[model samples]
Target: MVDAHRTFVIVGGGLAGAKAAETLRAEGFSGRVILLGDERDHPYERPPLSKGYLSGKEDRDSVFVHETAWYAGADIELHLGQPVTSLDREARAVQLGDGTVVHYDKLLLATGAEPRRLHVPGTDLAGVHHLRRLAHADRLRNVLAALGRDNGHLVIAGAGWIGLEVAAAARGYGAEVTVMEPEPTPLHQVVGPELGQIFTDLHSDHGVRFHFGVRLTEIIGQDGLVLAVRTDDGEEHPAHDVLAAIGAAPRTALAETSGLAMAPRADGGGIAVDASLRTSDPHIFAAGDVANVDHPLLGARLRVEHWANALNSGPAAARAMLGQEVSYDRVPYFFSDQYDLGLEYSGWAPPGSYDQVVIRGDAGKREFIAFWLKDRRVLAGMNVNVWDVTETVQGLIRSGRQIDPDALADPSVPLETLS
Candidate 1:
């Protein structure tokens, strides 16, 4: 008993697109649904590609959010390996690379971002890889296995999530790793410097070499093979392989071509989205990493490329498309599981702008939760291998209660009692 008339078309088969389609069905929308993805594989999780999948510990099948049969059973037509070339906004149809245009009543653009490439020379040399897609991970896995991780030198450029995850995965395979970060702290802009310092300590203790305030000038290679990477400081880092995880640029080419308004950020690229996740075009909507949703609390538009974001925003977009009113107000939360150290952080404080940093437990021993406060309000908190304090601490924060600095610093006093 499918409603065969009202057509709903979703582009991009990543987490956001897949989840949105599923939620549409669950909400009793039996309309004709078509999901188009560039990749042939089923909609899979990309987060594990940098960790579990790359380490050869997790298989690619485990990366999918739903099985192939789920799409078939849901009566949703899925077009994989078919790259859409252009979006016809006026006609409400998507033109595929194959010269076929698929029409729809409602269209969704969950097309995610693309990895920003290294501008330095020799970046195109062999043995230099970018970790964003499953195929990329598979290629890197084969390269790492052949290099015999125990002694291979992995020079990772950029201290972002992909780079750090690759470094941690390489270390899991016993590869010697060196990470080059232009910023002093890896999560400097996100969590602020204090909590970012604790992250540096955790990675450092894991035997990962980190260089801050440095940039790669040129990559040296021999006949298409990477040999060494030179820095702005006139230092050359020789390595067997290079993991370039600088960051990602929003895949706004299609949006840009469609004349949608691009959101401006002081740091550069991001696509603008309204309160309901609609773009400049009232007929279209966007989700996932590509769209910058305005932070309801901070009154700032932020683009988050975290798994929780994809999972949460997908349903929100689906609801909005269905003419239902909804708000994307979940405080941004992200986690990095490096070696045995566990890090979970929620919200972002103003940069270099915390009045006080309350610490529970000891960061020296690598067990503590740090809260950054501004105007006696909890702006952000980071739990380093300290799970017991997260829920309670986050509650106190959500309740908008001010916490005592001394009581927070003492491990003897549980964070819950302070409120």
Candidate 2:
């Protein structure tokens, strides 16, 4: 058992940061653990922010991973709303926003990520929001609350995870919503065009209008608040608010400024992390949306911004920091509930590796699953309106076996024996 000689300092109090701190105690690290967060709220589940929290089905307390008693009993120092301004690697210390310095033996960076900013005209105007932090969610929730009744409007830019979940929640509250994406199909980048089309149809069935193949040029405002959005197609949309969810870029400026051997990307993208989730410096580790960990099956590095990745992988990094020789070899899994549809997805396919995909069940019936395959091996799979088959398909992907479409598509074939 550790006897308080070593101090484990974790930066950023998001899902990853919280999980990492918990994993240390669970893994038998009894030394001092300090968790610092920029936001005052405890590390809560963010996926719900775009859904239940925004929909008013849940409140702020629902956001926390555990109650207040859990942290106090665990002997963890909880520092809320305290952000690290700089890292002095040479001194093994971190400088806080209020000029307080924190010394540490090992530093785990779960710094998470920030949404890409939209600097177009009227961006500074109120009602133009980016759904990233909990404070932003609270603001949107206030908007919905002030309406006094159901039905408002949400004009969302980018069809990524956050935008869809927000739209789904708003629609649940009887809000008229529209989503605009630059791609013909929003999920095309992840699941390919075929399955993405299925999502388009799913949203359309629920009266959610989609403006495809378009980009937001400007957000028009009235009285310093968003009134509408103008698109590249020379069309203007009158909207109550605008949400920009294009994507997130890693906040690696502090690490980079410290001369921590950061990698360069042509487009200024995600932070690079090895299999152990260690940055260029072995002493400094990273996890969550900010770090680009390698996908074992894909044989390529990827940044999975899903809650599952953060929850599981963060602890794995913490374990490594505690002298445990472990590697992060988990598949990417994420889910979203839109209208009556419960969509689950996993295991991104290798680039251009699949010639065709075999889908099982019907789409409109909302009870179907599709498999992305290459060389008969299940690269990735998604289940829509089907929960029973989740365990079956997930087992197939876990086994990494050869599968026959005829057998899988039949629904009679037990997914367990597909090997």
- The per-model lDDT (C-alpha) reads 0.82, 0.81
User: Model 2 misses residue 274 by how many Å?
Assistant: 2.2
The lDDT of model 2 is 0.81
Pairs with backbone N, CA or C atoms under 3 Å apart (clashes), candidate 2: none
User: What would the per-residue lDDT of candidate 2 be over residues 128-230, giving only the tens digit for each residue?
Assistant: 8888888899888777554325456779898877778777777766677899999988676777787778778877888789999999999998899777899
lDDT of 1 by residue, 1-419 (tens): 67878888888899999999998998888799899999988998887888788878888789999988999999889999999899878988889999999998888888998888888888888878988888898899887776654477888999877887787788777778888889988867666676678768777877889889999888888988878788898898878888888988777888888778888866334668877888887778888888888767556677888888889888898888898997777777777777888788887665766788877788788788888887777777888887855667667667666766777678888666866
Candidate 2 global TM-score: 0.94
TM-scores of the models, in the order given: 0.94, 0.94
Clashing residue pairs in candidate 1 (N, C-alpha, C atoms within 3 angstroms): none
